[model samples]
Target: MKSNTPRMPGRPKRQDQDMPVQETVLFTASRLFMELGYEAVSLQQIAKACGVTKASIYYYFDGKPQLFTASVSAVLERARTSTSQILVQPLPLRERLIKVSEAKLARSHGDFETILREARSSLSQKQLDEITSKEEMIHDCLAEHLIKAMDAGEIRRTDPLLTAHAFSAVLMLGIREIAKGTPADKLARDIVDLFWDGLSIR
Candidate 1:
C-alpha cells in the first residue's frame, strides 16, 4: 500500500555518494578530531561517520596517524589558500590583518597547539614536518604582505616573520577563555589596533 506523500524536491539524495570517497573520509576525520581531539577519536568512528566500512578507511590510509596527518595537512593547506586570498585584496594592511584575524576567530577549530601536543608522540617526524611546512606557508604568506606594507610606509620596518608570528600569538590570546564573551570583530579590531600602535611609523 503506497502512501500519498510526495518525495522532497532538491538535489538528489545521492549527493552524499557523489562526494569523493577520500574527501569524505578526510572531512569526517577532520571534524571528529577537531571536536574530540586526536586521542579520543578513532578510525572506527571516522569510518562510521563517513558512512563507509572500516576496511574502506584502511584502503585509503595506512592507519590513524596517516589519516590524521592528511587531515591536518589538508586543513593547513586550505588555510594558507584563504589567507593568501585575503591578504592579496586591496584593503589596507591593518584592515587585511583584522580581516584575517576576524575570519579565523569566527571559524571553529580545535586548539591546534593542544591537539598537536597531545598527539606528538603518535605523529612521525616526517608527518610532523609535513604539517609544520603546511602551517608555515600561511605565516610566510602573511609575512610577505607585511613586508610590502612596511616598504609602503603603512607600517614601520620590522622583522616580518616575527611580526607575523606575533600577530598570530595575539589572535590566540584574543580567543582564549579570558576573552570569551567579546565579539570577534571587536576582538580583532582591538588586537589590530594594539598591534598597529607598535608598528606605526614614529
Candidate 2:
C-alpha cells in the first residue's frame, strides 16, 4: 500500500537554478569581457564561470561577437535607463545634473568602453549602429533637460547640445580620478560644484 503524493514536477533542472541560463551567460560573459578584454576571454571561460557548457553559451548567442555586442548593449541600456530616470525628475536642472553626474561617475569605473575598443573590428556594422543609437539616446536626454533648464532661466542660455557634451567631458574627468583611487563621493561633489558654478546664471 503506497501513498500517492504529487511531487511538484521536481523543479526543472536548469544550468543555474537561480537564474535562466541565457541571462547567466550574458552576465558572466559581460564581466569577463570587461575584465579581460574581448580578445583575452574565451567562451569556454564564460561557460565554466556560469556552470554550463560552452555549447550552452553558443545556444543563446551566435558567437563571441554577438556575446560581446549583447554585453555592451546591456550596460548601455542600463545607463540609458538610469539617465532617463534622472532626467524626468521634477527637480531643478542643477540638481538633476548633479545626480546624473554622480550616477555616471559611479558607473564609469566599469571597463565597458575598453571591451568595445578592443572588439571594434570583430563587431558587425549593425552592432556598432545599435551601440551608437543607444549612446545618442542618452546624450539627447541630457540635452533635452539642459534645454528645459535654459528656458526656465535655471541656467545660462547656451547651445544645449554643446553644453551637454561639455558637461559629459567634465564628468569623464571624474572617472579618471576614480580610477586613480579618488573617492567617488568627493569627486562627484567637486565635479558638480565646478560644473554648476560655470553654468549657473549669475
Q: Mind sharing the TM-score for model 1?
A: 0.88
lDDT agreement with native, every candidate? 0.84, 0.78
lDDT of 1 by residue, 82-166 (tens): 8999999999998898899888877676677778888889999999999999988888998999989988888898999998888
Which is the leading candidate under TM-score? 1
Candidate 2 lDDT over 27-133, as tens digits, reads 88877776678899999899889887777776677899998888867877888899999889988776777788788777634454556788899989999988878
How many steric clashes does model 1 contain? 0
Taking all chains together, each candidate's TM-score versus the true structure is 0.88, 0.83
Worst 10 residues of 2 by lDDT: 7-16
Residue 84, model 1: lDDT of 93
